[model samples]
Target: MNLIPAYPEIFLLIATSAILLIDMFVSDAKRNITYVLSLVALAGAAALSFYSFEAGAVTYTFNNMFVSDPMSHLLKLFTYLGTAITLVYSRQYIVSRGMANGGALGGEFYSLSLFSVLGQMVMISGTSFLSIYLGLELMSLALYALVALRRNDAVSTEAAMKYFILGALSSGFLLYGMSMLYGATGSLDVNAVAKAAVSGTIKPTVLVFGIVFVVAGLAFKLGVVPFHMWVPDVYHGAPTPVTLLLGAAPKLATFAICVRLLVEGLLPLAIDWQQMLTVLAVLSLIIGNVTAIAQSNLKRMLAYSTISHMGFVLLGLLSGVVGQSSNGAVGAYGSALFYSITYVLTTLGSFGVIILLSRSGFEADKLEDLKGLNQRSPWYAFVMLMLMFSLAGVPPMVGFYAKLTVLQAVLNAGQVWLAILAVMASLVGGFYYLRVVKLMYFDAPVDNSPIVASGDLRFTLTLNGIAMLALGIVPGGLMAACETAIGQSIGHALKNLASIAA
Candidate 1:
């Protein structure tokens, strides 16, 4: 077995364990040492991922259960960036809330966070059912703990319990679906399953039956409507940092698994799964946008906004194929990939602003809290404005380009109505997003305290907001990166997908 493909995961695991041991002797007052080490581990792993990147090439290890490819490397790089920035943004917030100190979360937040990133890395690299499931559980468990880390917070406890229960149910759905696929295909490896799915020897009916549960599981993870009951509650109830933790990095991992399972593993059933995704996309867009309009709680509104944005991602996923052809598969999937990456980047900034406003005694979670932010600090307010514009899919921001590409992909795939519907949904969604901007620029100041954030947080938040506009103006590079990554993986799979479409 070529262990070379697994180096990043292995290094992360070892580094995380060492951080745990080293932190045991360090006092909470000196916890910055642990924080520094955690960031170093993430940076090291990111470097390794970048070094190993190979366009249009794939490598496998651990008896082919772990695969390293361009897409994995790219997503892993973004994952590292997202996780590190999340820590930087939330560092003071965590300390102020006592999650970094003695009686509550202790130093485990750092270790648990690293471990969760490791799990996400594993998930991004997973090439088989067992590996994917193992990775999912690891990440889910770490996040569950992180959610309840504030031991005395009744809301955190409730949120953690709900997340755990829903998470467990989703896992069960995934495992059952995998078992069904295994029973039909007589294999656990994704490649083997792909082969079996297209072979005339296996029963297509059985595969479709299994795909239902699989899509259900995937839908739950993506936080689309119907399966999205847990999202707003959890996002509102969990500590803001944990909310960012749950929101950002894990999305790339989930997108990876969705592609790995549905596109790579079961391209033969594209038509069936695409239909499922279509219904999910429509419902998510309608419900997520409409409900978000009613929320005064900023976190919950963002949570619903997450659902609608995910619907656009589903649009790209489902647009990969038209009947009897793999036409537009690369562009469609690439658009979805690009959208996911940019969405996370935008989300990190938006939530970072929320965290920046939160003091030891203040949560800064209500919509009114953002009132007259521009009057307080024009720079921070400007950053928040860019992030809101991005989320609202306004032009000159990355979110606009992301949506445009996905809509183009959908149109190319012959879903003209879907594309139109997506545009309308975005228009409706823009109201709440722009409402925030209104509060920041026009509303009276509710509190006049000076905005204070660590230098690192401010630096990253500034860069993050700038990246949104930068990518929108010249989205070619990231767009091409996503296209190339998806094209490399889809090159062979499209041949099979063609047959399924036919």
Candidate 2:
């Protein structure tokens, strides 16, 4: 087995353990050590993942259970970068709230985040359902504890409970789906399953049933409606930094899993799955957009917005299956991948601002908190405006392109009705997003509300906000890179599946 491809994960594992040990011995005054260590580890991981690209074509090791392909590697690169950014954005928030002070403070959160990153790394590269499941559990288990970190808060406790219970139920759905697919095909490998399904040898009823269960599990993680009950409460209750992490990294990993399972493994059954996901997608669009208009809490509103975005992403996935064009699959997959990256970055930027606005004894989650934001801090207000516009899918912003790419891909797939529905929902969703922009610029401040953030927080918060503009304006380079990654993965997956089938 070639061990070089695994270097990124190995480095993180060792570094995470070291951080944990340091936490046990480090004092509150010296807790900053954990942050420094985490940055080192994350930087190392990022470098390693980048290095793999130059080595040659993507390859799977360990009997093809895990593959280090361009797509997975690219996502991991963003995952590490996003993780590092979150750490930087989180330091002041964590320290101020004593999230870095107590016995479990400083190092513990960083360590768990590193562990979660490791799981995400594994998840993106997984070539088998078994591997993905293990990675999912590792990531989910750490997150459960992270949500409940503020033990004294009843809301935190309840959020943790809801997350844990719902997460377990979803995991069960995923596992059962894997079992049914495995039983029908007698293979645990995704490529093998795809080949089997495509061969038309399996019972139709069993295949459809398994696909439904699997998509349900994926929908839960992606925060789509019907499976999205946990998102708002969790976002509202968890530490703001945790909300940042939750909104950003794991969603990327889940998107990878969805692409791998649906586009790669179930390509042969595309016709059936596409109809099912279309319904789910439309439902998410309607529910997420309509409900968000009524939310007073920023977190809850963003949570619903996430659900709507998931719907858009599903449109891209469904398009890949239905399109007649040869490049349709590649376009859909690339669009979805790019959408996820932008989504994570924008979420980080938005949450970073929330983190800065937040202080001890202030939740900073209500829309009223954003009133008169421009007058208090023009720079922060400007940043928030950019993110809100991006989320609203306005032009020249990354979010617009993200939605456009998917819609284009969906149209290429001939799913014009689904594409139209998405556009309508985007218009409706645009209303709520614009409301935030209006509050920041037009509304008078409620008495006693002011915007304040620490130095490091401010610096990163600005950069995160500007990134949406930068990428949106110069999206060609990133879009090209995304296209290349998805193309390579799909080509290899098809070749491998064909070889196995013959």
Against the true structure, whose TM-score is highest? 1
The alpha-carbon deviation from the true structure for residue 364 of candidate 1, after best TM-score superposition, in angstroms, is 0.6
**Model 2: per-residue Cα lDDT over 1-502, one tens digit each:** 7877788999999999998998889887787888889999999999898888655378888788898888888899999989888998888778778864563347778988999999999999998988999999999999998999888889989999999999999999999998999988999999888888767778978888999999989988988989999999999989988888898999889989998898788876777888888888999999999999999999999999989988887887787754223447787888988998998899888888787788877877899999988888888889999999999999888999999999999878877887888999999999999999999899997744565666777888888888999999999888888888888887845554345436
Q: What lDDT does candidate 1 reach at residue 162?
A: 98
Off by over 4 Å in 2: 103-105, 323-326, 447-451, 493-502
Error of 2 at 355 (Å): 0.9
Model 1: per-residue Cα lDDT at residue 468 = 94
Candidate 1: where are CA atoms >4 Å away? 54-56, 103-105, 498-502
For each predicted model, how many residue pairs clash, with residues at least 3 apart or on different chains? 2, 2
lDDT agreement with native, every candidate: 0.92, 0.86
**What is every candidate's alpha-carbon RMSD to the true fold?**
1.3, 2.0
Instruction: List model 1 lDDT by residue over 400-453, tens digit each.
Output: 999999999999998899988988999999999999999999999999999878
